[model samples]
Target: MSTLTERIDIQVKSRHELDEQLEAAVRELQEAALHVRARGILITRRLPGRYTAELSDHVPFGMTRELLR
Candidate 1:
């Protein structure tokens, strides 16, 4: 039997350019206010609820409270 491993590669132009790239990425997320998670080069998205509210709407207050744990 053989096992397969998955890997992702991320390429950037320069270290100093990282801030600019992050800013652009944040702007994109804020414009839609969706959850964004990145691992290596893989990016995942979590959509918001149907109700129009602030980012807090997506997460329950109790969940946020427990997150302090």
Candidate 2:
């Protein structure tokens, strides 16, 4: 399976703009045609609820967090 983690912040004046942005994003992803070792997809969205920079570490299954340090 493949996992996609995305965080998008919006401060748009109209709903139509949001819809258009979403459509463009979807099309971009589809055009990329990403390669995956597994057959399924998993997506996670994290909205921090406040304006702040975020960080992420992509560690796959069977890996320990400490190993990264």
In terms of lDDT, the best-performing candidate is: 2
How big is the positional error of residue 62 in model 2, measured in Å on the Cα after superposition? 25
lDDT of 1 by residue, 1-69 (tens): 632222212235565554455445434434443233221222222222111112234443222111110
Best by TM-score: 2
lDDT of 1 at 20: 58
lDDT of 1: 0.30
Off by over 4 Å in 1: 1-10, 34-69
Point out the worst 10-residue segment of candidate 1 by lDDT.
44-53
Q: Rate the local accuracy (lDDT) of all candidates.
A: 0.30, 0.32
Error of 2 at 28 (Å): 0.2
